[model samples]
Target: MCFRLSAEGTVLSVNRYGAEHLGYERNELVGQSLLRVVHEEDRPSVSRRLAECVVVPDTTTAWEFRKVRKDGSVLWVRERARAMTKPNGEAVLLVVCDDVTERKEVEQHLLEQRAQLRDLRLELSLAEQRERRRIGAGLHDSVGQDLAFARMKLRELEAETLASETRRCVEAIGQHLDEAIRATRTLTFELTSPILYELGLEAAIRNLVDRMGAQDTIRFTVRSSGSDETLPEDLNVILYRACAELLLNVRKHARCSEVEVAIECTEEGIRISVQDDGAGFDAGGAGKGSDRTGGYGLFSIREELQPLGGRFEVDSEPGRGTRAVIVAPRERTAIADAR
Candidate 1:
């Protein structure tokens, strides 16, 4: 849930989840000091963290802390807090947190037991690609070889036998086998794109943009700016998927013929935007299940965007096209450097 507080820690805004969890009505939470809800153990650390953020007001941090519920139950929470300023130049804070007590506990336990969670993450990535290659090898080595052998035997049968119907059936079976092998090859590449594993994010994206542009019905263009420096593979995947989602949303909800995808990188952060020339609608008209519909595609995009020092904004009108922009810290990539 989201909470926007004034400099004095008075709640100026409480999201629907915040209002329900704080055991306060919508109006009651406003103007209430959020410090009252801080669990005693975390009060010192939480306050310290906040101080560290405000002192510089440039660096951002994501943290996990405990907070006392009004019902007297303490929940382990993870906070995505950012330090900002109000119009009057007062320091204001906006926070989004989740009751991840159970999840945090699980992560903590795993951390303690596995001493190699970071290593495992690295291996998990490599292993995921290795497994894809293995599947590809299976298709090429076993299935592909079988198809070749079958075709050879069928050609021999065609030469030796005189039954026309039988020869045609044999050829068809051979064709099916060849088609199956081709499909398997395609599946392997899609599962773990070789370009990403072999080259890097920039080249892979360039290739992806080229492929997208080559499509017949819809036209696509991509603009890359900012730091094109190498980044963690996981960041590449997240950014790639986020862009892919936007384009897909365009294909589904937008009836436009062309779209533009742009990426900008700076010392502090990176921004990605996907804009379309299709019909748009009132974002406020979205309902709970709108996410399942085309309306909430941007919402899902935000879910992926926010975790890594990222944020997203959607702009659209009834007739004007939709533009989704994602902002993220350049250093805050999902995949850390290998130890």
Candidate 2:
């Protein structure tokens, strides 16, 4: 459809097809205001764009807006318009419109599907966190407590008189029990650290780095800033997991001795960076099925963040080092309250 409107938005002329398309006769559309057929909700924006075209005269401005037909049905149209001088020494807008209702409908459908998928993923993450907390609590309250009680009873028995051989056997059993208790505690912390829920993301990360650094194979340093408020619980969990993943990849593949992790709050959101002075590989080729740095690979980590309004980036060069950064959006309007 085509239309020629005066600079003041009066419809000077409309093509035969354009008039009939709106259920109007050719003559009936002449001398009408162009805004008459525009959807009420879109009129303001259409008016603004028209003013812009008049200001920038020969430049084409394109946008999608809703137009109302003669029968009062709305139609989505992709419009392209340009203002130009007419032979009568007046300015007019030459407009071309294309039907885009089907495309618009498809786009809306895709957006709804994406929203549904994000909600489902959030539900699953929350469910998984609850399960982790339950198991961690059971390990601490049941098995851990039981083991401690047994150790205490063994100590009480040891205080009594016993033969040398018997005492030695009891001592060995106590040592084994100690090992078991330590292992259980480690597993519990890994499953769900109370520090993460009690403290914020920065504190939890510091604890993780300190614990890992104790191994002595790698030296880890953590620095953070701009973390004045606590993040949503579910968001913290995901951010924690992503940071842990990067650290694991460094431990397993970087083959370097020093690692640095930084957490900061930016205008966009929270940013976490993990850098290692280890064996770096070709990050460019890493996307082409190469993943020397394992643990959900770099590409997989990026793909996972895309749906959560987050970003994962990696910079690396062979024999230099690797730096991985993850940014998680600060908003939690769609997320439910933490359990």
Which candidate wins on TM-score?
A: 2
User: Using Cα atoms with residue i matched to residue i, what is each candidate's TM-score against the true structure?
Assistant: 0.51, 0.73
lDDT of 1 by residue, 1-339 (tens): 788866456778888788788666768778877777789878888877766656655456689888877788878878877778667777877788888989877988997655455345444645665676667667767876787787777778767866888878887887886787678666755665557656765566667667667764778877887664655556666676666667767777778888888888778767888888888767665323474236436555565455555777877878898887878776753434332
Clashes of each: 0, 0
Stretches > 4 Å off in candidate 2: 4-13, 31-36, 39-63, 70-72, 80-96, 158-161, 226-230, 253-257, 265-271, 276-331, 337-339
Q: How well is each residue in 262-324 modelled by candidate 2, as lDDT tens digits? A: 899865689899999988988887744359756457665665466567888889999999988
Backbone clash pairs for candidate 2 read none
Top lDDT: which candidate number? 2
- Where is model 2 poorest over a 10-residue stretch in terms of lDDT? 330-339
CA lDDT of every candidate: 0.70, 0.85
